[model samples]
Target: MTSLSKGDKAPEFHGLNQNNETISLETFKGKKIILYFYPKDNTPGCTAESCNLNDNYQAWLAKGYEVVGVSPDSVASHKKFADKFQFGFNLIADTEKEILQAYGVWGEKSMYGKKYMGVMRTTFVINESGIIEDIFEKVDTKNHTDQIIKALDIK
Candidate 1:
């Protein structure tokens, strides 16, 4: 799997959000971006991670940051997930896997010794200029917001 690192340019991506509205990297330009890739919608780990971000979303916004979650789910699924959880940010539907592959989060993963290609739980901290500031390959689902806050050294 190709790994993106700090100082690298975040890949440009555009897709439909939970509301079926077009969202792209350009939409978040000039703002710090929390671009997280999850395995699926409504899953246990994913739910926890999303809720944590939701809980701390206002703080992020106040600091000029925006949180966006990406997965290969459909727009309808994303809508339901957001509505159920009251997520404060956008959930991008990467149904074509283009954004996932571009970010290098789509790769081989093993579950119970069965290896397969799927989305990896990853988060990218991108600066206002679209340069990657940090990469979280091993995300702590339960405390993901804390992880980001710590990584970015947000006060």
Candidate 2:
């Protein structure tokens, strides 16, 4: 649902991570960023996606990429989720949905004919300069890391 596309400047944002520490796009300046947005914490699909990424986090770091996840869940929720899974990356708590809206990932969604506003699952591969190198709208939750590597053609 995001209007942002590849080659666009990724929107700047600042929010509290699961630890309640402030995290901002500025914090990752000059580093390739894997910025991902998800709907909630502790859900099946979200858990699978997050675990897959966390499982391969070291490989991502070795490749010079930092992973960050954003969700509308509260800081407490994020903390629990991250702690339970022992995630090695920052999980930003977008409780106010500010980051979500800025990235255009917050929008109306439907489930079983019921429509509601929620965060749309998305990932933006940002370059060292903060430019979006690729956008993944249709994520493969169980194999997201491999999906990203293949999509970016990373060797």
Candidate 3:
């Protein structure tokens, strides 16, 4: 779980996308950002969440929000996943977990009674001024985009 809260300054982050292109928070300066962190690539929940965003990509863009997903997956894995889903936005390959840690989404999680350290699913809605407007900790995978729309009050 992230210590960050609404109205907090979003942590600066830079990482490579599936295409090996550098992407940073600076890259989206003056634009609203939906930075979502997932555990891995090609998982059921992750896929549903990403696909929901893809389905509403244009709506988000029209509302001036740039959506991006992050995961601790390799560039190659991200490439495959994005290609398979034909996502319209960037998927940052956080192989080093630097961005994940900076966002405070890298932490311990329990699954099936087993506790382990991993990336917790999280989303940060950052305004054009680079301050967090909302944070989504309990994401609804298939309706994730709807959740964002509600959170940001985007018409």
lDDT per residue (tens digit) for residues 55-129 in model 1? 999988998889999999999999999999999899999999999999999999999999999998999999999
> Model 2, residue 138: what's the lDDT?
97
Query: What lDDT does the true structure give each of the candidates?
Result: 0.94, 0.97, 0.92
Best by TM-score: 2
- Candidate that would win on lDDT: 2
Ranking by lDDT: 2, 1, 3
Candidate 1 stretches with Cα past 4 Å from truth are none
TM-score of each: 0.97, 0.99, 0.98
In the range 95-121, model 2's lDDT, one tens digit per residue, is: 889999999999999999999999999
Q: Candidate 3 on 11-123: residue-level lDDT in tens?
A: 99999998999999999999999999999899899999999998999988998989999999998999999999998899999988999999999999999999999999999
CA lDDT, candidate 1, residue 125: 90
Q: How many pairs of residues collide in model 1? A: 0
By summed lDDT, the worst window of 10 consecutive residues in model 3 runs over 146-155
Give the least accurate 10-residue stretch of model 1, judged by summed lDDT. Answer: 1-10
